[model samples]
Target chain A: MKILIGISSKKYSEPTLDVGMRIASILKSSTTILDVGGKINEFSYKDVSIANELMESWDLDRPGVEVLEWAYNYLIREKYIEKNLNEIGFSKNLLVDKGNGRSEVFLKGVAVKNLSLILRNGDIIEELRDEVQSFEYDLTIIGGSGKRSMAHDLIQYIDSSIFVVNNFNLKQKYRILLAVDDSPGTSKVVKFGVRVAQAFNIEVDLITISKDGDFSEKFRIASSRAEKMMRRSGVTAKVKFSEGELVNTLVDIAGDNHIIIMGTSSQSALTKFFLGSKPLDVMESCNCPMLIVK
Target chain B: MFGFSERSLTTILFWVTRKKWLILSFLLSISFFYFPTPDGLSSEGHRTLIIVLVALSLIVSETIPLPAVAILILIMEVVLGVDTPDGVASSFMSDAVFFIMGSLMLAVSIVHQGLDKRLALLVINITGNKTWRIVMGFVTISALLSSFIGEHTVGAMMLPVALALIRNAGLDTGKATKLSSVLLFSIAYGCAIGSIGTPSGGGRNAIMIGYLAEFGMAEISYLDWIKMTYPMLILEIPIVSLILWKTFTPSQKTMDSSVRKLKVQVAKTGKLNANQLMAIGIFILVFLGWIFFSPIFGLGIVALSGVFLYLSFGLINWKEINRNTNWGVILLFGSAISLGIQMKETGAALWVAGQTLTYLEIIFQDVEIVRWFVSVVVTGLLTNLLSSAATVAVLGPIVLDMGGNPVITGFMTSIASAFAYLTVVASPTCMIIHSTGLITSADYFKAGWKLFIISVILLLIISLFYWPLLSL
Candidate 1:
């Protein structure tokens, strides 16, 4: 599996890096950590590049390189990258221009299967969307500082399962709130939930919700199958059936303590765009981190 | 639902969201096309205005690439029957467009020579260790150098000097501080105010000169331009420096160690090499060509001559110039200038100018003030939103048609466009400083409003009390 992690700054992205790295280590995913800088308007793009070149001559890094260096330090500290590789340090000279405003540096990984750092400029959604579409990553992870407003675009446009690491507090132990439904996506969602449960070494609260307190046989069967999958994967699990609304019930149960794992809505993309999907709605309202499996 | 896959549908939806402005512009243009032409306007003028609206919205929104917008303007001019293909093509490649293209290449060729270290040493030696003196020196040197060379070239060269000083001051170069803000704004604002000093200082000045000549109004020689605007440029230097120092005054009263460290660091690069000398000598020849021979061989050809010399001397290569030059800007400005000429030919500029005077006369009650307001205030504000050259190109013909002395009005519009102090998108120099991550959008307004007001008053004073003495 390939995972893409979007980071912005040293101060706000620590938890995102930690969470993304931990999951990547568990899944042995080929991971990329990306930093998106401010958009340079086209009128001044060439001029700004000229200035950036001058800055380099002065032995200074361009705008986004510092963030990549910080992420590199994090990798070294966590030993996610090979120890000997840290000796050379994070050099801006190592950033290879892959064109279309993307530059990357490849690194040998200790835990993850393959690792690379990418730097891109422009609107966050467009850059992330382009990165995901071009790279064909299975999962794209981002921090939640400003993800609430972008949740719709992230879910709608990005061609990957999204993991928004929202307000993750390291001290608080998190449980997996694996949301199960009768949709066709629930099987894949259950499999991802088991991997996450193993990654975090946490128990799962397998949730099945209905609007009118009438849980259909298909919903019961889907929940049973998810629980069975969790059991087979050696993940500790508990089953809960709720009757309010799907987004409200899940957000309430996963309040600040549980990492919500749920399948993307089976609604058509056009419908999901005009009226948001359940995962997007939950992502907007919920306070905890979430993984919306595609 | 439309027999497409979910991924393709999402991709289409994403494109729609990203390019909503482009869609809206097309719809607006189509709707406006059916509106009856106004009383003073011809059918062709009406169509030209439609194209203008579409181009403005697209350029400001930047929903499409600039080159695409340029091509759209050319296509609309012919399709809308505003002009013939031959006329549009002729208007699209003016000497002013050549100047913009040549100057952009010249800037690339010059910057590739790496004279920034020499520039750094020269600035520090003149300024010494006092923080205030260094700030003034930066403003003075940036203003003087950018007046001769283009502002983007000067801004690019000056950034490293400012950043090196900040880094040597024991501050984190990655972080924004008052020291960094003041020093950086010095370069940005200094380059901005200085751009009005000469015709070669900015592309907008060339565009204005082009408009004046194209409209058969007046001919402004390169020396004549410097004579009219240089005094205002000189006056603005201290004012800009003082405003920036006051707005973002750092706690470090003296950058003693920083200056010493920067001097040592720049010293390690050694003295000016042979290539650097050849580059400077070629640039001086270019400046001399502008002052002495521009009238004989237009400013565009003279600047191109300098680029030729640089290439012949191997000071820069075609590959480097090709890589660094902004071809899109040249295309867009070419399109904008063509539109401006069409505005004049189709009587669109005259109609708009007449309507503006008729409406604004009620509030200001004076035609002169209305003309001045449109040329200075409106152009100033729009320059902050659109690019300065684009602002001048679109607004130039209308201002010239507004009944004042065309030289004064055109010159005022060009000078006012340099008041790009309010936003990062105002000018390339502003964006250059902003790319360092030191100056925020709000930080622009902190010092920008003061300089904006000051510059307007200064330009007014020069126009009223000083410029009449030139008797142009």
Candidate 2:
């Protein structure tokens, strides 16, 4: 499996890098880290510096010269490629021929690749969106500063699956929550969540929230089915039901270092999901990482 | 509808879920037409009552969106011959409505400038590690800003600060600790209380002010309004802090780690830029104008000029303002004002007040204090269900027509309308806090009833002590 991590310029997020390492190592996945210089790079290339520092810290014996050299050259080549593309009446997008392709590094026995690309003063969010779609990534993880805009922008365009992590702790036992309901997307959400859980070797809890206990029977059936699906995938599973609004219930259930994989197209959440309402609502308050699957 | 085939079952459920409100609306409209007209009311007044009954029912039930319910009121008023198009149009565009529109625009512009980061720095700087102190910091900052900048904006800005504190607290919402409740409730309740402190605090204040002027009262100046209300706010802040502190007593004493993280979070926000400085300057200028010159220019014109300055100074663009400003809320306010004006014009308000006043007068025997209590209760109850502005628009007219002190009645109704402590849908501030996804509607009910009772007691105490001294 292939994992994609987009590291931003926000410092003091070493925990995000650690989170990426855990996910890659557990799934035995080939992970690619794209350290894109965001809006903060205009004043300073602090994003590149942080990426280099984290890379060197991750692998002490592997002299960091090769990674830094590759990263610097990649930045230079990216600029030249963009100018060449503009000269041919073909505007440059980060999706194709973007990033420093030569920059690749390994992190603690995990096959890690680092691409230091600068979006440089344009719509960095849009540029990053295209860059993420270039790979058929099974899981795309992005570092954030616990701001609503960072998670909201990435969640708006979900190609396959995405995780927006903020202030993640380095040493923590991650809890996995599968937020399922009777939506068209639930089956996909359940199967994908279970597969990821099995890969990460984590216990999965299936939670369904009903408003005023009106959907107890339906939630029971849904959680039961989800539990069976997870069990078949060789992942430990538990089924639970509570009654409240969906987003609020999830917020109440989420613990530290927990990853919430939610199905947005449920009966109560369908309309709000289309409006880009519930995901951001949950993200703004939920202290843990979120993997929203459509 | 039960025991049906798959497609038939789907069709049945669809109708029951989606179209039930439409059916209820139709039945309600037909039912109200048959409602008996009250005594001493014109035929036009009776028709207005029918429209009011339907509109209020739909709004309370939430069968349709609220603004749509308000628009339907406007449409039905014309269709039922309660008022003419020209009269309705003029009523819809009052100075009070313009003030609401302009204040909402100013709020959106202020929030868009990213000044909340600066506010967060100030709040966290004051609240270093002590859990109780942090709670007070949030309350103090929110109360101070919401008095001038409006409650909804302050609520929206202060919401992230509280949430960040919760995250740093490492307290899980699943456990639902008293500490968490203390933090979240402080922001919501602070915004609610502060909204009553100044003329610009909320549209309901301006609505009451405008109503008093139109109903043969001296135009209450901005400073005059502040003198009447700020003392009550001064009394309210500590009382509110005590209420929340006692209701949700924290299990632990200190939040050392969370406090440290808060300091770091404040430091991380960096410095304010030019746009933020200009936004703050514009806001201060507007606030000062409201304090000094609103009596001369009137509050609405002064507020409108501030929004014009926000535009001309390039602090915020028209598109951002247009996007952030809720036109639906403005439409709802306008239509509500139009309906309120109609209720006053056709003697609907007087007739309604007359019917209720008969019973109260029999009990109180012309006692002004007892009549004021009834007015406050009625306004408070209605405010819980409707927006404060809508509550003031509807009930302000009826109570002012009740023939007591118009200024006192206006003040009472406006303050009581902000007594929306019970429901998540009670006020804009409550709604914004609930959007944080931390507190549930049930949690609201749990804490709300207590605050409601406390707020009632506080209002009466102020009425007893301050109202007489100020001759309000």
Candidate 3:
């Protein structure tokens, strides 16, 4: 499987990348880190002027050189990203295309490619949309806050399943929570979650939103199918049902869970007038990371 | 939720939200049809007035897409019998609309060619990195380029340059970074001021020229336009620059780092590619054509020819041009011209002009200065409300009839219309800059009023001193 990990800004934390690295190594899959740098137009004089004073050139009209230089030194030479890559036993290579440039990094246990994209002057969402559409990825990872948490808004814009990670702890074992509604996509979400949990050698605790007496005959049928799907992967699963405001109840139960997997609602006609998609709302006010699948 | 696909529901919800705005515009427009044909209006004038009112509501409320509103104007004109179908078609498209379309296409093509690295290299080299001086650097480049290439193009070209500089420095956007505000506004206000400089600067200027000739006046040459308005444009630039510099006092003092980065960025391109040189060559040719042969070829023809040259030279591909060029804006512009022409032909413009003239006369009692001032004030205000060109289209005939030295009246209307400072949608240039998401409407209003006051004073001085010196 191939995964696209999104670094919202250049100043991303190690944990986000670490999560991708761990998952990739565990599954022995290909991981691509897309580092999104804001475009040239969005930057002020101060951003490009990081070097002491200014560097004056007479060559006139070439672009991508100075930015490439800055990214090289900042991300590679300064050992900013290099040391981080080395710590994870990843090999880095300078990737250049004529005047424009990026870097490709590979980890030992899995195939990892690093790409730096500077948007210049367009919507980051659109840029990501185009990038994702350009290739196929099973899932995409985004940090929980700032532009990365844009994973919330991006749920509608992108096609792949998304995992918005907040306060991710590599030191702790991941306890998976699969939040399901008796909706069309619920069984699919649970199936995908179970596969992920099986790879990590963990169990998935399936939670459903309902009035909660007997977990409903239909809910039992849905949960039974999901448990059987996990059993196919030799993964154990448990089920719990809740009777409260969906987002609040899920967030409350997510404290002990390291990752929460939720099925996306069928996006009703009135959804546009409302706050946000159910998956994003749960992701926003939650205690841990969330994986949203269709 | 049970049967509908998520995508289908999203599409439905999108249209439903749009329907809300469309419904509001529809109700507001129909409500005003019973307004009993204001005292002096002809029946056609009343119908035209009803269309204008509806157009205004749609534009202001923005319940539908702007292109839809443009189409609505054309449809309303024919349905209301303002003109024959053929007449409406001919009226919808004019040299002014042609110029706007051609120039906008040209702008998108130029930006697509990625020449801003060269522009950035040149600017940073000259500006020497003091943030304010660098802001001035962008100001000078934007204004100068906009004067010839038009603001939409200049604004587009400059957007990435400013963003590169800002993001390179790691400054936050959305008002947290004053430097971001200054750099972006310099482009916005620079485009605004320069757009008033020549006929090529904006669609409004060309539309005004078309109006002057159509309203039965001696033809105003492109150079004659430069002589009449360029000085005022020059005068406004410093005031705009000062206001931007003052209002967005940069949190950082020096931009040496950004300049250095820009220098590196420029160097990365190595040497100019063939496409870059071809783009430059094409722009110079177009600039010379607009300047030397606009009277013969028409500015619109010259601009459209330049677009063909770019295409033929293989400097840009058809797919790229198609993606970058906004056909909707072109349609909107054509409809504006059509609407303006209908306003003139239907007697609605004269009636509106006469009523306005009466009110102004009552207030100022036949003072010539007050007439010009009113023309400037009313056009300026309207320009900020709608698009500058649309404002000129609506007001051009009305003000031309209010009567004074036709050139002065036309110049005041055209030049002041470029002051789209207060609102994002006021000018194409402002809207383009706003699309960058670096500044807010509050930022516009913040720097705008001060410049607006200064501009009014400056215009008064120009009317008193500059116009007479030029024998207007």
Candidate 4:
């Protein structure tokens, strides 16, 4: 397995990138560090000058030279550190952007390299529509800071996998709750849930809510699908289904569960995720932690 | 459909007719004179009044979208032989709307660039997490921004900040309802204070300056306005903060001691992006221009300059800037201003004022004492009920008719205008806050009454004692 960890040329990105590289090394996977340049366009140099002039005219506090120097050093460290990692018989590469140029860093060991697109906000999603469009990662290992909204966004985007290192000292076996719907995504969801169940020696309970009614037939189909996924993955699991309001039903079913895991299409954020008539209804009603997989 | 029985409809109609009896009577009298007789309302001069009122209601009720309403109003004007379509259209796109559009673009850019959040967070950090501290923080920031920017912009800016804090803290959304209500009203209060700090803070402030010039009192510069108002704001901050804290917060003192966590979160917030920084710069420049450059360049010019600069720089596009402006509020402002003009021009306001004074004399039997007391109470309460501009317009000429000095009239009117201190829906601040969907109108009414009482008393103190001392 391999991963591509992108880093910005800022001091803040240093600690996060270091942690990412360490996790990749532990997982025995090749890690590529992508160094994103500050120059977003050809006129970036002139843009900086004009930015300073405008700031001064407005009597704003100007960006100091020290910060600029730190940015440059951080970019340099990306290449040097990757070389050091490569020396340890680990597959490591540094991808740097020449000023105002575009580039890509591929996860080479993956079966499909074109699963996701890395573009800025306004980039046309349609341009990459044909790409099977999975998460950028098969699984992402993150440190204990679960508070960052951006990290939450990245996890949802990939819908790959997430491993949250919690505050508890123990390498605890996580209790998993899988909320399933009749979609292709459910197959991947069940497989992932079963792998987790087997690995942690925890039982898996699959609950499918019949939002459209007539749950008996749909439940049988979902149960068979879960069994088939488990059989293929060489794991045994239990499945059941019930019917009610979506959010209320899910929350009630997830009582005392360690986490509520579900997936959304890429580009969901905190606000859009919580928007509804009773937007906070589920969060207020739910007792256990929610791990929303986008 | 939710079944509304005929019996229920009849009951509702009975109640509505009973409550609206006075308005019904007035409407009946007008219709009886104008419609059936054709001799009742003189069509000679009242044509302008009739044309403007009908046009205004259509625009404000927004039964149709603004452009459609504007077109309809223009068409109706031509059909009614009131004016040409071109003249009506030109009137619809008034200078006030243009000024409002320019200001709205500036506000929207500030929001888009996320500068408003940064400024808000800076205030929150400085004030700490104590309930009183939070109130003080909101008041200080609102007052400062309202003074420099417009009150409406300050209200617009702080609302999102209050919501973001509530959501990020994982507190109950109910907490947001009251706190946001208070914050919005604070913004309105700040606007009131800030307007007095500068001539361009509001239309009323400019009118007050013009009145001062007419009286040859002083050339009240920006600094002079600030000098006069800042002391009052400083004195009132503690009182307002206390009232708000008492009203919204729980009685128990369970302080949020995770100060370090808040600090870390603040640190983690990414630095201002280039666009955001540019917007802040433009806002500050425009604000400074309003304060110091008023003698050379007018406020509208400086404001439009900032708007144009941001547009030319690609900080915001034409669509973004255009969409940022609220034409509804602008139209409302024009309508209010036009009503004020008509009230004075028609001799109706003065006649009504004379009748009110006569009634007051019959009740109190002392014209001077009754007049002064009536002036204080009526202006104060009306300020809370209506938009500050509308409140001032109604009260300004009334006080003038009572033979009070111009400065005293200006002082009392300005004080009343600031009385939106109590509720979230009373001012621009309240309107912005209410729009967040955090604070409902009901929430403001329930919890806001206590704060309203405090504000009313404070206004009384200022109007009776503070103004007399200052003006003397």
Candidate 5:
């Protein structure tokens, strides 16, 4: 599996990097860490580039390079990347221009299958969407700074399963809240939940919510299947049924302690766009980390 | 739902959201097209106004590429019957466009020569150890140099010098600080005010000169431009430095060690080489050409001659120039100038000018103030939103058509466009400084509003009290 992690800076992205790296290590996924800088206006893009080139001649790092360097150091401190005998530290000269406003550096991974760092400029959604489309990654992980429109765009446009590392506490233990339903997408969500449970060696709370407190047989069956998958994966699990508004109930149950794992809404994309889906609402309302399996 | 896949629908939605401006402009254009042409306006002039609205929205929104906007203008001119294909093509490639193209290439060639190191030494050697002196020196040198070369070129060259000083002062270069803000804004604002000193200082000046000459209003020599605007440029240097210093005064009163370190660091680059000398020599020849022979050969051809010499001397290569030059800006300005001319030909400019006077005259009680309001205040604000050149290109013809001395009105519009102090998108120099991550958008206003107000007053004083002495 290929995973993409979006990071902004050294201050706000530490927890995101820690959680993403831990999960990627467990899954042995090929991972890429990306930093998106501010958008340069089109009228001044070329001139800004000329200035940036001049800055390089003066032995200075360009705007986004410093963030990438910080991430590179984080990777080394965690031993996600093996230390090279010849190369001692992160070097700006190693960043290879991949064109289309992307520059990347490759490193040998210790736990992950393959590791790379990428730098891109422009709107975060546009750059992330383009990166995902061009790379075809299976999962994208990002820090949740809680911008509603950014969450909407990420859920609607990015094809990969999204892991928003929101309010993740490294010191506090976290449980998995696997949101199960009768939709066709629930099966994939169940499988992903098991992997996540195994990755963290944490227990799972299998939740099945209904509007009228009437849990149909299919809902029961889906919950049972998810529990069975968790058991098979050696993950401790509990089954719970609730009746309320779907997003509010799930968010209340997850609270700030559980990492919510759920299926994307089975509704049409157009419907989901105008009237947001459950995953998007939960992602927006929840304070804990979330993984919406697409 | 309509036999489209879910992924396809999402993709379409994304495109719709991203390009909502483009769609809005198109709808607005269609609605405006059906409205009856107003009295005193020709049908073609009405259509040209629609095109203007569409182009302005698109350019400001930047929903589409600039080159696409340029092409759209050309297409609409013919399709809307505003101008014939031949007429549109002829208007699109003016000497102003050539000057723009040549100056961009010249900026690339000069920057590629790695003369910024030399520039750094020169600035520090003059400014000495005092931080305030360095700030003033930066403003003075940036203003004077950018007046001859373009603002973008000087902004690019001077940025690293300021950054090096900031870094050597034991501050985080990656983070924003008062020292960095003051120094960076010195370069940006200095370059901005400096661009009005001469026609070659910015593409907008060339565009204004082109309009004046093309409209048969007046023929301004390169030196004539200096005689009129250079005093204002000189007066603005200290004003910019003082405003910036007051707004973002650093705790470091003296950058003694920083200046020493910078000087030592730049010294390691050694003396200028033969190639650097030749590059400087070619630029001198270009400057001489602009001063002495611009009237004979035109500013555009003279600038191109400099680019030719740079190429012939191998000071810079075609590949470097091609990589660095902003072709989209050249194209967009070409189209914008073409639209400006069509505004004149179709009587749209006259109609707009007359209507503006009729409406604003009621409040201002004088045509001169109304004209000044539009040319100075309106153009100044628009330059902060749209590019300075694009502002002048679209607004130049209307201002010239307004009832006043065309020279004064024309000069007012051109110079007012340099008041790009309010936003990062105001000018390339602002964006260049912003790219360092040392200054924020809000920081622009911390000092910008003061300079903006002061500059308007200064321009007013010059136009009313001083410019009448020239009596062009």
Candidate 6:
């Protein structure tokens, strides 16, 4: 089996890449590491100013390199420590594209004046679109740092099938909770999550949270629709419904669950306050690994 | 149990607060007929309360049409004895309303001519496929059209195209919505900056111009307005584009070489869009007329000429033209303007202005500085909260009455007038964008706060240096 792991060049990249490469080796699957960065022409003075500030704060020597170099170093160091995957079984090649590609050496090689160039949103999207369209990986692993802000909001806006990585010990048995919403995007998530559940032979429970009173009608209707989706995916999932408050219901359902998968949709600032912030609140409270699929 | 009980109580409380306007209106009607407020409380406070309650009542009714809601507010104001019948009737014809109506009509003509699309396409094409470049292109183009044509029209023209591109890219609908939302916000923000570029971009600009007309020496011609505004558009758009792109780029790579290649490929598809080209020519001609010819000729007459030419040339049919014009918006403009005029006529705005200075004297001490501070902060926040035109309509007379310096007031109003970046519903362009499922109300508020902060800094710079030096 081929599994592709994608990580950003920031703080969480090393641990995520190490963990991912280790798991790929144990499974004896071919692993590919993709590091995302601003293209050479894509950087800008504004971006350099921001990047330099962050780099200075992090005590990193290379402040003006492509974003991919940070992730590449993590992957290389982890490979040296193990000598297990890179040696006998698993193959490692630094995948770099003309657009969305990144490498530690090349990133470190960049100068401050050159950092002002940055790629377009469409280019970044196109790079990912081409990479995903070409690759036939069974699963695409994503390394997400929990720092919440406008940056996370931006990432969520560009890619929807994201898996936020967090540290938690695996149990003998896994309890997976999928919080379904009314959006059509939920259908893709249900189909994807079911496949993962079946692969692990884990029991999957589908849940929907409705607001109290009249608005609950939308949730009740959505819950029935979600049930049909789960059944169609060939998963005999248990369906649950609740009302009262989003945070309370989410926290209660999260209890004892191995992993909780929730869908975050694109919302206006007002609705995001009402909708998107719940997952962040849940992430803070729940010890269980929570995955927010945007 | 506690959580459940507390949740139920809170839900009940929310429901009550949401429905309070209806409850308050009912109680007020009873008090007016049955109990009545004491004569001591019968002054402007209760009348203002009634107006506020009545407006809230209109907003609360989902089943009622907005026009019907406005009618209800009018009726309640009359019945509740807030305004005399003559006063109420006359309140519908405020200067703000006239300015907004005339400006929107001109904007619709531009829209009908297909000018907005042509300009938008030109910008996107020039930017190539570079992500930041495309964003800058979209922002700049949208800003130019919106500033000259009308912000809402720019949003209407660009949103569909942006959405179509995302869909064509074979991207996720949710992600597409996010990017589209950012694009929409940028369009709105850009239009806002652009509106200040010309006296006719928005009603408020015209209102400020009208107020300055009385000053004789306080001159701000169309070309001069453009000169002042274009620099602001240039300054903010790149930063907005960078911030938007940096904040929204996905975690997993979705963009590839094909996407960049696709941008080049998309240009080939641009050939068949001739209506888009005609639209561009008509838009530029009208824009030129507005900037250059209108000052020598009459603005309304020149604007109507463009409308006639577009119609006669079959650039837009009557049906397309009518639907494109937002009559509801026209009514809102009229109603707000009338209210503003009434306030001016009643010397209410002057009274408010006097009270405002008294407070400013205590805080600011220096009258000239207070005047500058007042013009920047009040105009900025009010225009951001309300419609820019409405802010001008209501506040224009008051600013004029301040009698310190017409140039200072004019520059302040113009600068503050462009500061509608706080909420999605604050401006017509915002509403147009918010309605398009591309951007959510929360998305605007989230990014808008930052933009608002930047705008404040920009306003401070303008008031502190740009105005004092430029006006002199």
Best by lDDT: 5
Name the candidate, 3 or 6, with the larger lDDT value.
3
Residues B273-341 of candidate 6 have per-residue lDDT tens digits of 566566557667776777777666645555666666677777777775564455565665555544555
Q: What tens digits encode model 5's per-residue C-alpha lDDT throughout A1-294?
A: 999999998889998898889889989999999999999999999999999999999999999899999999888888899978126799999899998789999989999999999999999999999999988999999999788898999999999999999999988799999889899999999888888887888999999999999999999999999888888888999999999999999899999999999988889999899999889999999999999999
Model 5, B1-472: lDDT tens per residue? 9998898898899999999999999999999999999999999999999999999999999999999999999999999999889999999999999999999999999999999999999999999999899999999999999998999999999999999999999998999989999999999999999999999999999999999999999999999999999999999999999999999999999999999999899999999999999999999999999999989888999999999999998888899999999999999999999999999999999999999999999999998999999999999999999999999999999999998899999999999999999999999999999988888999999999999999999999999988899888
In model 1, which residue pairs have backbone atoms overlapping below 3 Å?
none
Q: For residues B167-198, what per-residue lDDT tens digits would candidate 4 score against the true structure?
A: 44555433345545555455545555555445
Worst 10 residues of 1 chain B by lDDT: B210-219
Error of 6 at B44 (Å): 8.1
TM-score of 3: 0.69
**TM-score on alpha carbons, each prediction:** 0.99, 0.62, 0.69, 0.50, 0.99, 0.53
lDDT of 6 at B204: 72
DockQ of 1: 0.89
Worst 10 residues of 5 chain B by lDDT: B434-443
Tens digit of per-residue lDDT, candidate 4, span A1-294: 444444332434454444344445444455444333221111012222223233333222222222223322432354423343334422112222222222233322231222111211111111111111322445543333344443433332333354433232224444667767765566666765665555445666666777766676655786688877776766655676777786788777767544455544322233333442221344345555443332
For every prediction, compared with the true complex, DockQ reads: 0.89, 0.03, 0.09, 0.01, 0.88, 0.02
Candidate 6 ranges with C-alpha deviation above 4 Å: A1-294, B1-19, B22-99, B102-121, B168-170, B176-184, B211-220, B249-281, B292-301, B366-374, B432-442
lDDT (tens digit, per residue) of candidate 1 on A1-294: 999999999989998999899889999999999999999999999999999999999998889899999999999999999988889888998899998888999999999999999999999999998899888999999998545559898988888999999999988899999888898999999888988888889999999988999999999999999899889989999999999988899999999999999988889999998888888989999999999999
lDDT of 1 by residue, B61-172 (tens): 9999999999999999999999999999999999899899999999999899989999999999999999999899999999988888889999999999999999899998
Q: Please, what are the lDDT tens digits per residue for candidate 2 over residues B1-472?
A: 2456533543344344444665676787777677776569988888877767776666666656666876898898889898888878888887788788888889877877766657767887787777777788877777878888888778767766665666677864323577767777888788888888899999989888888887667588787788888877777777777777877888767877876776776677578878788888888888898888887777877888889999999988998777567677788788888888788888998998887788776887875855576668878888877778878888888888888677877888898887878876677777655533446677777767777777778888887688778764
Give the alpha carbon lDDT tens digit for every residue of A138-244 in model 6: 44455544455432342323233444445544434557788877776676667656655654556777887668534456666766776776677666788877675
Among the numbered candidates, top DockQ falls to 1
DockQ of 2: 0.03
Which should have the higher TM-score, number 1 or number 3? 1
Candidate 5 docking band? high
**Full-model lDDT, candidate 4:** 0.50
